[model samples]
Each structure stands twice: as structure tokens, then as C-alpha cells.
Target: MNKLTKSVLALAATTLSFGVFADVEREFSETYNFSSNGTVRVENINGNIKLEGWDRDQIQLEYTASADDKDDLERIEVEIDASSSHFSVDVEFKKKSSWFGGWNGSSGEVEFRLKVPHEVVLKMIDSVNGNVAISDVYGDIKAETVNGKVKIENAGSDVSVDTVNGDVKIVMQQFKGDQRIKSESVNGDIEVYLPENEGFRLDAETLNGDLSNDFGIEVEEGKYVGADMEGRYKSGNARLLFDTVNGDIEVRKD
Candidate 1:
């Protein structure tokens, strides 16, 4: 082949190789030493975060911070520190140094998935438009979201989930320690499913919907949109509190 033809072939091959090996995004991972009484705090603003509990004693974190321009993501950092007897994880945003500083007109997102020890407490705070899921944890959980949904499954301790405009669902076996469930939404419903013998200081109310329960408790006769019942189950232990502002409240025993 001639020199120009060979040069064209070489350029095409290099382009193909670059397409095959180049990464449009990057992943960041870090691990920190943890204690049994430590707490894992995950905070994010605009993406989904999933936390799974493991059987080890370490904090594992993985996240992908990406944007149209890589410089915008430079401001995103995950900070892990030992605070008192607990470990805290936070998503830190680097502030702009000057008037025209720090990704003022950039668009990107990051997704974080971590696996921490099951014995560590969890504190999750999502500011806006982020969903959170946690599973297989044996520690106390406190989760709050302003415009997102929160879901917990197979939890082994007390959990409190609150959302302003999203539905909350919790499915667990039991709360060996004292537990409390408080879910409130101005435009969403609250549903609680418990074992046949679960009990607590029961108080459920609704403002614009009906209330129905199947645990065989005595509700007072009143002029209300929901039932005003107060009694303890045979094996009541956890303190169950359920509320809904403009939706129905249901208690189903399995």
C-alpha cells in the first residue's frame, strides 16, 4: 500500500482502539475502619443510593461521579471520619472560591452504593429528588427524604422513615428492641404489615380517608373518617405509630 493509504488505515485502527478502551465515566471506591457502635451516614442530592448490610466490620463505599465536563465532578467528594464512638460518611461539595468558580453551569449526577457492617447505625438524608433503599441491616435506621421514596426490607432493628411527598414501605420480622414507625405524607398513603402477634402503643389516624385493620383490636365508636382504636396485642413489643394526612391507613397482620 502507498504511504497515504497506510496512514489512513493506521488512523482508523487507532480510532477503533480508542473507542474500545476509553471510558466515558469513572468509579471511585474507598474503605474505612469501623466499630460496632459506629454510624454510617450517606447524603446525596439527585441520585439513587443503595446500602446493603454485610457480615463484616468495615465500611465499603462505591460511587460514580460523572458529568458532561469532568471538572464539575471535581467538587464532589466523600468524607469518612470517626466521630466520637461512631463513623460518619458525608458527601461534601467543594464551595466556589470566587464569583465565577465551581461548575456554575454544569449538569451531572452520581450514584452511590455501599455495604457497611450490619451492626452500624445508618443515617440517610436526601435533600431533593433522590431515592434510597436499604436491606439486611441489624442496626437502628433513621431516613428522611424531601421529594423521594424510602424503602427498607429485612431490617433487624428499629427504623424511622419520613418523607414529605413519597410513599414509605417497611417489611421486617421483628424489633427485638423497642421500635417506632412514623410515616407522614400530605399526598401519599401509609401501609404497615406486621406479624400476627406484633404489638405496640397503637395510634393511627387519617384526615381525608378511611382506616381498616385486621389485628382484632377494639376501636371506639366515634364520628370520624378513620377508626380510633387503642389496645395492645398479645405479643406487642414495638411502639407502632402510623399516620397519613390525605390518604388511607391500613394495618394488615400476617
Candidate 2:
């Protein structure tokens, strides 16, 4: 063979080596007719979940599932059930045994991005090993995660968030009625932002961490190794609660 032929073969070999390590990915996109007052639910594992609110009367979902092995990528499945009033998306993983007979670990990661009606309620957004984020939403929201952060912005209604090993942050654009807000973390910080002149009853506590706020509520040091604050602002009709085991808590004015 000529020198040029040898160089071409070498380049092809290099490209094939790189391809061997590249991850396999699958993409999905779907749209459903939905109502403004509908409910949305999502269940995922091992990847991030992001949601945004829009003015359109529909739900748009886009997701990507990736893995190192093509077989593992095939094991990841997205199950979606939708209607005019309710929408649900669940990420399911099929189990397989390893060479030694033990069950293999997670199939892959599934990242989700969704756009829903502005006034739809997020009844549940649960994840086992990924972050959950929401923005520009005006209905009640509930989210929980085992090992990832949870964040919300431009919220206009009640909120409930919890995480086992990640931080939590919430920004309230406006409070609706006497809505209740609660957040808790096992090993991460918690921060909440609200209007400067909003009225609410605040109850915040932290174990093995400090407490700070922009609401002027007195942070009382615990007897041993933590701090807490409980007070009311203005009308104090709305209730807010925050707790953490091994992190700080902050209530900020927007």
C-alpha cells in the first residue's frame, strides 16, 4: 500500500476508537392539548427535570435519554399519559442481570424539559437522582428529590419542596391568597425569596447550620449546634415553613 493509504487507515482507526466511547442517546418530543387549570406530574430517575410555564393552552415535552451502552439506552423508557385536563410522564428502567448474575445498576439518564400552561398545577415532580427546576409558573407546585437540587422562580402560588442531599431555592413573584409554602432538606441549604412587603408567618429551623434572613426575623441560636427563627410579617395570613438538618436557611426579600 502507498503512504497515503496507510495514513487514511490510521485516521479511520482513530475515529473508530473515539466512537467506541461515545454515549448513545435518544430524543423525544411530544405535544398535548391541555387546560390552564390542569394538573401535571413527572417521575424521573438519574437525570434533570426542567419545566417552564407559558401562556399557550398546551403541554410540550422534550426529553433525551443517554447511556454509555446501547443496550442500556434501550432499557430506558418514557411512559407518558396525557389528556385535556391531566398529564403524566414517568421514566421507567428495565432491569437486567450482569455477567456475575447480580442486577445491573441504573439503565441511563433521562433529561426532561417541559412547557405547560401558566396556570396548571404541578401536582408532583419527583426524582431519585436528578435536579428539579421550575420557572414562570403560577399554580401550586410540589417537588421532591433524593440526591439533587430543587429550584423555583417566579412562583405565584403555594409551593412544597424537599431534597435529601441537595439545596433548595424558591423565588416568589407574587403570593396568591393564603397559600402555604414549605421546604425541607436533609443535607443542603434552603433559601426563599419573597416580596419585600409580603405578609406571612415564618417558621424556619436548621440543625448543625446557621440561619439568616432578610425579613428582620430574629434568628435564635439553638441550645447546642443550630439556629431557628419564627415570626410574622404584616398580615401574617400566609404560612411558610423551612427546615434543614445539615445546612443553612435564608429568607430573602425580592
| Top-lDDT candidate index | 2
What is the C-alpha lDDT profile of model 1 across 1-254, one tens digit per residue?
A: 11111111111222211123332344666665666656777677667788888877777777765544444455555554553345555655454455776544434455778887887788654535677788888878888777777878777777777777777777766656567666666656666677765566677766676677787766554475545556677665677776667666677774
Task: Report model 1's TM-score to 2 decimal places.
Answer: 0.75
The C-alpha lDDT values of all candidates are: 0.64, 0.84
Per-residue alpha-carbon lDDT of model 2 for 1-254, expressed as tens digits?
A: 11111111112222211135587677666677788999999999889999999989999988777777677776776777777788888877878888999797655788999999999999999999999999988899999999999999987788899999999999887777788899999999998889987798999998888898887789999787878899998885788999999989988888
Error of 1 at 15 (Å): 20
**What TM-score does candidate 2 get on C-alpha atoms?**
0.89
> In model 2, what is the error at residue 87, expressed in angstroms?
0.8
Q: Please report the candidate that would top TM-score against the real structure.
A: 2
**Each candidate's TM vs. the true structure?**
0.75, 0.89
Candidate 1, which segments miss by more than 4 Å at Cα? 1-24, 82-85, 92-105, 125-127, 217-230
